[model samples]
Target: MKQHIRLLKTYLKPQRKRVVLLVLLLFGSIALDLLAPRQLSLFIDGAEAGASLDALVTVAVVFIVLTIAKQLVVAVAGYFSEDVGWRATNALRADLADHCLNLDISFHKDHTPGELMERVDGDVGVLSDFMSLFVFSVLGRALLAVGILGLVFSTDYRIGLLLLAYSLFVVLVLRRLQSVGVPHFNALRRTKADLSGFLEERLTSTEDIRANGARPYVMHRLSEHVENLVRRTRASMISARVFSSVLEISLAAATGGVFALGAWLLPGGSISLGEIFLIYYYTQLLSLSLIVITHHLDTLQKATGAIQRISELYHTTPQVRDGEGGSLPDGALDVTFDAVSFGYGEASRTLDEVSFALPAGETVGLLGRTGSGKTTLTRLLCRAYDVDAGAVRLADVDVRDLRLADLRDRIGVVTQDVQLFHASLRDNVTLFDATIDDGHIERAFAELGLSDWYASQPDGLDTVMVNGGETLSAGEAQLLALTRVMLRDPDIIVLDEASSRLDPGTERLIARATERLLKGRTGIVVAHRLATVRKVDHIVVLDDGEVCEAGPRERLEADPASRFSALIAGGTA
Candidate 1:
């Protein structure tokens, strides 16, 4: 409920003027409708009193004028309501999209893309219906109901009492129905999210399913999700239909009772024929008003479910954020890990009191087995997650004290898993930066020995790479990833060197490009091949996050007692 109100406040504050105008238009339209029946009553009485044809003509003309005025007001109200509703929803969706992009990486780890998309898309759709119809309908019906009751009372107190009692009963029924609807709709919405997440996971892993011939298994799981979704939807629809039925029946009962009572009172001269006729019209108007109220109630119930879903996302705070009054150094680079110990929650430490330092402009090689904390160390350098304990510093300034952007701007990372978007090659290389010209892109590609590959493509730099397309081979893809990082040209580079088996020719090419890219720049290479270590200035051997040995590569390789020498002798390098 709090979340729903928060979302409403965001849109309502911006659209208060439109809301007010819509209210005025609805009141005017309903007033004209209620008054039109009264005018007809006067016409009927004039006819019974032997009035001339001119009197009937004047009454007819007034009725036509009132109807036309009401229609014009209604049309304008509908147009403005829709205009404000869509505009407000668009603004909200934009804010949600922006928030998703800036959220912490761990947030993505916990949520699927489809779930987020549904919150932004489906949830906003729910809000749109309420803003466009339910909100305006509620205001219009309230004014119409109150005015009609007051008008009825002016004519006959007994009739007014009867109508008011019936209206309260109908209202109570609708309110109870809504109370039941809220929870059911909320259940339906959760099922929708589940279906979305399930479908997304399957689509992303379609190739694996096909390769493994697990079609039957996947189909069965999808069928289960679909069945659950259908059940929830059916239940919600049944509830709505039942509520509408009750409202319709109650309206019929009230209309009949009003006629019976009016007939009895007319014999006592408590009401005239024209008054009885107008009372019937009032009862019909009340019925139509109740129907509209029921319809809007269903819409409001659906929106409440949606609002609850979206609010959950907006309320979540990211685990990672910028530091207080922090700034980056304006120098080459000096990275140090002072007794750093880190882990994922409650798990064994991935990095345990690991300490090391690299002077500015020096290249170091990090050798470790899988899960030995090589990538974890690079993640720390980028401040992807805060350290569990100890400190990582650059140029004697604690990383925690540096502004997030400034800290990340000084470092570049190229992981083994390279993800490319379905966009033009130029966009991928420059990361959509308008300031990076073709010449700069060309230089980055040329430096990485990818100029020929780019030139061979039919569209050159403008060619689109499909998502997950093997447009570039393993080595070529690694080279392009290098080009991406080189475009940033940060002071520190962390390379999770590719483990793909490269031919002699491709190996030599990568070695040369790697040397050139690391020249006079501080670098840490998560080395996969033994030859990669020989070229580095220093070597750090890690075993389960703890540093086993650290020294110049030649010195470590020469020491028989060293972990590096033992691994070399064991032919595990």
Candidate 2:
């Protein structure tokens, strides 16, 4: 509870004036509520005393006005509470998203998108509702309870003692029930996240599932997951109901005592008719508070469970963090892998003491059999993953000692897989950065010798594209990726089988663009098809994660017995 309050303060602190206004409105509503009952007591007492009709009417009118004012204040408080809760939770969600984005590739690989979505969206939403309820549903009603008890004690000590015991018992019992309920609800939330992950995976692969005739299998598995969720949800509800049942039973017992005591004391005239009504009505008010608490108790437990999960996520420190903020030297940086060794989390080494170098402003082709660590080398160059041992140096500066942003800024990578968004062509080309001028985009296309292809678009750069480039061919998507790299004009660039998916005509266009892109830049061109190998100054061949051959491309190709010469003859690596 202390942690919950602390978190509320943290998020609510920025909107201090709104929160203050909300608190004032809540207190005003509670005061009106408390005052209304007092006015009712006065009206009854005045009527019983044979007072003038006008005096009784005035008291009744006052009670009506207080009731109306309470509702109005309550409505205003609701608005402010919701407004504050929404802003705070949205800020929390944004922070969580930014944190997740900074996490390394390994963290993303371990978590499903759907699971993350549930954490960011579902959990935060629960916290948002609970935040609002904590103010009015819990604290405001608590004050009302205290006020009711205080008035009762002033009138009669015995009744106040009875109701105080009732209140204390309810609190203690509900708290115990909450401790037992949290685990079940936590399990329920995890199951929901699992279901969401399963659904997201299946939905994304709908094409494969339908084409492979695996629909029945998918449906059967989905049914099993749905059934598990249903069972957990039922179990969770049953656990929650225990709190409600306890409160109802306790309320019935307390209400019986208040009625019995009121009747016994009424006959002796020890308590006036008006005073007796006040006690009964205030007892009813106490029961209402108990009901409100009972209803929100489940919410409290859900929020408690959400906070635990959110805390765990918040505390997760990323494996990849910024280095000592070292700066890189300007323009066409040389690349080096010095005795580098790496593996993916307990797997066998993918790159074992691999050593290589390329002079500044020179292009090299990386040749390898499948799983020979070609892609891994490029990833290390960009510091997507740090080396397990040894250093990846650019311009002779150790990459581990440089800030990731600074290192990556100078090295641009265009992979074979191009991901496009559902947005305008300019947005897609600029990756949603609107600051880039159209003139630069035109210059990039012209440099790539893609002006003719660019002009063929119905709306040129303003054309909206479908998500994942479904509206564009594979070759066109790759071209867009090249355009992105061209725009960046980094000191170092990597191309991963860039021309693999194109027709001969598109291949020529990409080859021309590839030549333009690699000009005046250090390049690591990965070629499985050997189409781009002829353009490189040097070649490095990896077999089983060790460099077996590396030399000047012209020298190696001239040797009939050399691996590069054989790979060129075979037309593949």
Q: Report clashes for each candidate as comma-separated counts.
A: 0, 0
lDDT of 1 at 227: 94
Q: Model 1: how far is 556 from its true place, Å?
A: 2.2
Task: For candidate 1, write residues 1-573 as lDDT tens digits.
Answer: 767687778877798898788778777788898988887888888888888999888997898888888888889989988988888888888888888877877788788887888888988988887878854487677678888889889889988998899889877887788889989999988788878988899888999999999889989998998899899999999999999899888888888888988989989989888888898898888788878877777677888777777788877776777777465556569989898888876768899999999988898889889788887888888888878988999988898887787888888887667777788888877778989998999988788776776788789789886666777666666666788888998889888765346677766777777777788789898876777666888888888999988888888889999888887788665
Give the poorly placed runs of model 2, Cα more than 4 Å off.
1-8, 468-470
Model 1: CA > 4 A from native: 474-477, 497-515, 531-534, 568-573
Residues 1-573, candidate 2: write the lDDT tens digits.
565567667788999999889989988987887789888788888888999999988999988898999889988899898899899999989999998888888888999989999998999999989887888888888888998999899988888899999999988998899999999999999999989999999998888999999999999999998999999899889988988998899999999998888888888877888888888999998899879978888788899999888877866888877889777778898899999999996869999999989999998999998899999999888878989998999888899889888888898888888888888779888998888999999999999999999998899888988854357888888889999989887989899888767799888888998889989999999978887778899999998878989989999999999999998888888
In terms of TM-score, the best-performing candidate is 2
The candidate that achieves the highest lDDT relative to the unseen native structure: 2
Quote the positional error of residue 133 for candidate 1 in Å: 1.9
Q: What would the TM-scores of all predictions be?
A: 0.90, 0.95
